[model samples]
Target: MLSPMQLSKKIQGNDSSQRINYLYQISKKVVEKNPVLSAYYGNLAVSVAKKNVLKIHPDIKRQLCKKCRCMLIDKKSAKVKIKNKKKTKYIQVTCNTCKMTKYFPANKGNNHRLWLENPEAIVEIVN
Candidate 1:
Protein backbone atom coordinates (compact mmCIF):
# COMPACT_ATOMS: atom_id res chain seq x y z
CA MET A 1 0.00 0.00 0.00
CA LEU A 2 1.21 3.48 -0.78
CA SER A 3 1.87 5.81 2.12
CA PRO A 4 -0.49 8.76 2.65
CA MET A 5 2.08 11.34 1.54
CA GLN A 6 2.92 9.35 -1.61
CA LEU A 7 -0.77 8.91 -2.35
CA SER A 8 -1.36 12.62 -1.94
CA LYS A 9 1.49 13.37 -4.32
CA LYS A 10 0.04 11.03 -6.91
CA ILE A 11 -3.44 12.49 -6.55
CA GLN A 12 -2.19 16.08 -6.72
CA GLY A 13 -0.41 15.60 -10.04
CA ASN A 14 -1.25 18.39 -12.56
CA ASP A 15 -4.24 19.59 -10.52
CA SER A 16 -3.63 22.78 -8.53
CA SER A 17 -6.99 22.63 -6.76
CA GLN A 18 -6.41 19.08 -5.63
CA ARG A 19 -2.93 20.01 -4.45
CA ILE A 20 -4.24 22.96 -2.47
CA ASN A 21 -6.96 20.87 -0.91
CA TYR A 22 -4.45 18.21 0.02
CA LEU A 23 -2.15 20.77 1.63
CA TYR A 24 -5.06 22.28 3.56
CA GLN A 25 -6.03 18.83 4.84
CA ILE A 26 -2.48 18.13 5.88
CA SER A 27 -2.27 21.47 7.66
CA LYS A 28 -5.50 20.88 9.56
CA LYS A 29 -4.35 17.41 10.64
CA VAL A 30 -0.96 18.67 11.82
CA VAL A 31 -2.17 21.78 13.65
CA GLU A 32 -2.42 20.20 17.10
CA LYS A 33 0.91 18.40 16.86
CA ASN A 34 3.01 21.14 15.27
CA PRO A 35 1.52 24.58 14.67
CA VAL A 36 4.55 25.86 12.80
CA LEU A 37 4.44 22.98 10.37
CA SER A 38 0.74 23.52 9.92
CA ALA A 39 1.34 27.14 9.06
CA TYR A 40 4.05 26.12 6.63
CA TYR A 41 1.70 23.77 4.84
CA GLY A 42 -1.07 26.36 4.82
CA ASN A 43 1.29 28.88 3.32
CA LEU A 44 2.34 26.37 0.72
CA ALA A 45 -1.28 25.81 -0.21
CA VAL A 46 -1.96 29.53 -0.57
CA SER A 47 1.18 30.02 -2.63
CA VAL A 48 0.26 27.19 -4.93
CA ALA A 49 -3.15 28.68 -5.58
CA LYS A 50 -1.68 32.11 -6.22
CA LYS A 51 1.01 30.76 -8.51
CA ASN A 52 -1.55 28.93 -10.60
CA VAL A 53 -4.10 31.78 -10.49
CA LEU A 54 -6.67 29.49 -8.93
CA LYS A 55 -9.23 30.50 -6.33
CA ILE A 56 -9.20 28.66 -3.03
CA HIS A 57 -12.48 27.30 -1.77
CA PRO A 58 -14.41 29.77 0.35
CA ASP A 59 -14.76 27.45 3.35
CA ILE A 60 -11.06 26.70 3.36
CA LYS A 61 -10.16 30.35 2.87
CA ARG A 62 -12.31 31.45 5.78
CA GLN A 63 -10.74 28.92 8.15
CA LEU A 64 -7.17 29.97 7.43
CA CYS A 65 -5.53 32.82 9.32
CA LYS A 66 -4.39 35.35 6.73
CA LYS A 67 -1.45 36.77 8.64
CA CYS A 68 0.02 33.63 10.17
CA ARG A 69 -1.11 31.12 7.56
CA CYS A 70 -2.39 28.88 10.36
CA MET A 71 -5.59 26.91 10.62
CA LEU A 72 -8.04 28.59 13.00
CA ILE A 73 -9.95 26.10 15.10
CA ASP A 74 -12.78 27.58 17.16
CA LYS A 75 -12.17 27.71 20.93
CA LYS A 76 -8.71 26.28 20.40
CA SER A 77 -6.69 28.29 17.90
CA ALA A 78 -9.32 30.99 17.42
CA LYS A 79 -12.18 32.83 19.08
CA VAL A 80 -15.57 33.35 17.47
CA LYS A 81 -17.96 36.13 18.42
CA ILE A 82 -20.85 38.13 17.04
CA LYS A 83 -20.82 41.90 17.05
CA ASN A 84 -23.19 44.70 16.09
CA LYS A 85 -22.12 48.10 14.89
CA LYS A 86 -23.79 50.86 12.91
CA LYS A 87 -26.93 48.74 12.44
CA THR A 88 -24.89 45.95 10.94
CA LYS A 89 -24.40 42.63 12.64
CA TYR A 90 -21.42 40.48 11.83
CA ILE A 91 -19.65 37.36 12.98
CA GLN A 92 -16.10 37.97 14.06
CA VAL A 93 -13.32 35.44 14.11
CA THR A 94 -10.08 36.23 15.86
CA CYS A 95 -6.99 34.13 15.31
CA ASN A 96 -5.23 33.51 18.59
CA THR A 97 -1.89 32.73 17.00
CA CYS A 98 -1.46 36.08 15.27
CA LYS A 99 -4.26 38.17 16.81
CA MET A 100 -5.83 38.59 13.39
CA THR A 101 -9.51 39.32 13.08
CA LYS A 102 -12.01 38.69 10.25
CA TYR A 103 -15.60 39.75 10.05
CA PHE A 104 -18.51 38.37 8.05
CA PRO A 105 -21.75 40.26 7.68
CA ALA A 106 -24.78 38.52 9.21
CA ASN A 107 -27.78 40.69 8.72
CA LYS A 108 -30.80 38.46 8.89
CA GLY A 109 -33.02 40.92 7.11
CA ASN A 110 -30.80 41.00 4.08
CA ASN A 111 -30.59 37.21 3.83
CA HIS A 112 -27.04 37.42 2.66
CA ARG A 113 -25.54 34.32 1.11
CA LEU A 114 -22.27 33.52 -0.60
CA TRP A 115 -22.43 33.18 -4.35
CA LEU A 116 -21.28 29.58 -4.17
CA GLU A 117 -24.24 28.77 -1.94
CA ASN A 118 -26.73 29.84 -4.58
CA PRO A 119 -28.27 27.22 -6.85
CA GLU A 120 -27.60 29.29 -9.96
CA ALA A 121 -23.86 29.17 -9.29
CA ILE A 122 -23.75 25.57 -10.41
CA VAL A 123 -23.33 25.39 -14.17
CA GLU A 124 -22.21 21.80 -14.34
CA ILE A 125 -21.76 18.82 -12.03
CA VAL A 126 -18.98 16.36 -12.60
CA ASN A 127 -19.40 12.74 -11.75
Candidate 2:
Protein backbone atom coordinates (compact mmCIF):
# COMPACT_ATOMS: atom_id res chain seq x y z
CA MET A 1 0.00 0.00 0.00
CA LEU A 2 1.30 3.44 -0.90
CA SER A 3 1.78 5.77 2.05
CA PRO A 4 -0.20 8.97 2.42
CA MET A 5 2.91 10.97 1.59
CA GLN A 6 3.20 9.20 -1.72
CA LEU A 7 -0.50 9.64 -2.33
CA SER A 8 -0.19 13.36 -1.66
CA LYS A 9 2.37 13.80 -4.43
CA LYS A 10 0.53 11.62 -6.92
CA ILE A 11 -2.74 13.44 -6.51
CA GLN A 12 -1.41 16.96 -6.89
CA GLY A 13 -1.33 17.38 -10.68
CA ASN A 14 -3.61 14.55 -11.69
CA ASP A 15 -7.29 14.16 -12.39
CA SER A 16 -7.64 11.43 -9.82
CA SER A 17 -10.19 12.51 -7.27
CA GLN A 18 -10.85 8.90 -6.36
CA ARG A 19 -7.22 8.34 -5.45
CA ILE A 20 -7.16 11.49 -3.36
CA ASN A 21 -10.27 10.33 -1.55
CA TYR A 22 -8.59 7.03 -0.79
CA LEU A 23 -5.61 8.78 0.71
CA TYR A 24 -7.85 10.99 2.80
CA GLN A 25 -9.61 7.91 4.11
CA ILE A 26 -6.31 6.39 5.11
CA SER A 27 -5.32 9.61 6.84
CA LYS A 28 -8.55 9.53 8.84
CA LYS A 29 -7.89 6.02 10.15
CA VAL A 30 -4.30 6.87 11.03
CA VAL A 31 -5.43 9.94 12.91
CA GLU A 32 -7.80 8.07 15.22
CA LYS A 33 -5.16 5.66 16.51
CA ASN A 34 -1.80 7.39 16.06
CA PRO A 35 -1.64 11.16 16.16
CA VAL A 36 2.11 11.53 15.64
CA LEU A 37 1.91 9.59 12.41
CA SER A 38 -0.99 11.74 11.30
CA ALA A 39 1.17 14.81 11.85
CA TYR A 40 3.85 13.20 9.71
CA TYR A 41 1.43 12.71 6.84
CA GLY A 42 0.22 16.27 7.22
CA ASN A 43 3.80 17.51 7.09
CA LEU A 44 4.37 15.46 3.99
CA ALA A 45 1.37 17.04 2.32
CA VAL A 46 2.65 20.50 3.25
CA SER A 47 6.10 19.68 1.95
CA VAL A 48 4.69 18.47 -1.34
CA ALA A 49 2.52 21.55 -1.66
CA LYS A 50 5.50 23.76 -0.92
CA LYS A 51 7.62 22.05 -3.50
CA ASN A 52 4.88 22.38 -6.08
CA VAL A 53 4.50 26.07 -5.33
CA LEU A 54 8.22 26.61 -5.57
CA LYS A 55 8.28 24.74 -8.82
CA ILE A 56 5.67 27.02 -10.33
CA HIS A 57 6.35 30.50 -8.94
CA PRO A 58 9.61 30.15 -6.97
CA ASP A 59 9.00 33.56 -5.42
CA ILE A 60 6.07 32.66 -3.19
CA LYS A 61 8.41 30.65 -0.97
CA ARG A 62 10.14 33.87 0.03
CA GLN A 63 6.89 35.31 1.40
CA LEU A 64 5.32 32.34 3.16
CA CYS A 65 5.84 30.75 6.56
CA LYS A 66 6.39 26.99 6.57
CA LYS A 67 4.70 26.31 9.91
CA CYS A 68 1.73 28.65 9.89
CA ARG A 69 1.25 29.44 6.19
CA CYS A 70 1.31 33.09 7.13
CA MET A 71 3.66 35.84 6.02
CA LEU A 72 7.35 35.03 6.00
CA ILE A 73 9.55 35.96 8.93
CA ASP A 74 13.13 35.54 10.00
CA LYS A 75 12.02 34.48 13.45
CA LYS A 76 8.89 33.66 15.43
CA SER A 77 8.15 33.44 19.14
CA ALA A 78 6.17 30.39 20.34
CA LYS A 79 4.62 30.36 23.78
CA VAL A 80 3.51 27.36 25.83
CA LYS A 81 1.27 27.18 28.87
CA ILE A 82 -0.83 24.80 30.89
CA LYS A 83 -4.44 25.90 30.85
CA ASN A 84 -6.88 25.11 33.73
CA LYS A 85 -4.26 23.30 35.83
CA LYS A 86 -5.41 19.91 34.61
CA LYS A 87 -2.19 19.32 32.62
CA THR A 88 -3.70 20.55 29.36
CA LYS A 89 -0.90 22.23 27.38
CA TYR A 90 -1.53 25.17 25.13
CA ILE A 91 0.61 26.71 22.43
CA GLN A 92 0.65 30.38 21.67
CA VAL A 93 2.34 31.21 18.39
CA THR A 94 2.79 34.87 17.71
CA CYS A 95 3.47 35.50 14.07
CA ASN A 96 3.94 38.89 12.57
CA THR A 97 0.38 39.01 11.29
CA CYS A 98 -1.46 36.56 13.55
CA LYS A 99 -1.33 35.81 17.24
CA MET A 100 -2.62 32.25 17.28
CA THR A 101 -3.10 29.92 20.25
CA LYS A 102 -3.88 26.20 20.33
CA TYR A 103 -4.23 23.45 22.89
CA PHE A 104 -1.95 20.47 22.38
CA PRO A 105 -0.99 17.35 24.30
CA ALA A 106 -3.17 16.56 27.28
CA ASN A 107 -0.44 14.86 29.26
CA LYS A 108 2.87 16.55 28.66
CA GLY A 109 5.50 15.46 31.13
CA ASN A 110 8.99 16.98 31.54
CA ASN A 111 8.64 18.63 28.14
CA HIS A 112 6.32 21.08 29.83
CA ARG A 113 9.32 22.21 31.85
CA LEU A 114 10.82 23.68 28.72
CA TRP A 115 8.34 26.48 29.19
CA LEU A 116 10.33 27.48 32.27
CA GLU A 117 13.84 27.18 30.82
CA ASN A 118 12.99 29.35 27.85
CA PRO A 119 11.45 32.53 29.16
CA GLU A 120 12.09 34.78 26.20
CA ALA A 121 9.34 33.23 24.12
CA ILE A 122 7.55 31.16 26.75
CA VAL A 123 5.53 32.82 29.47
CA GLU A 124 6.18 31.65 33.01
CA ILE A 125 3.32 30.91 35.37
CA VAL A 126 3.46 31.51 39.11
CA ASN A 127 0.90 29.45 40.89
lDDT of 1 at 99: 93
Q: List the global CA lDDT of all models.
A: 0.72, 0.38
Worst 10-residue lDDT window for candidate 2 reads: 118-127
Candidate 2 lDDT score at position 19: 34
Candidate 2 lDDT, 1-127, residue by residue in tens:
5564665565564533333233333433354355345444434434555454523122232222335434222232233444554545553333343344444443355554443233332122211
Per-residue lDDT tens digits for candidate 1, residues 58-103, read: 7778778889988877766778776888888887888877899988
Model 2 residue 113 lDDT score: 46
Best by lDDT: 1
RMSD of each: 5.4, 16.0
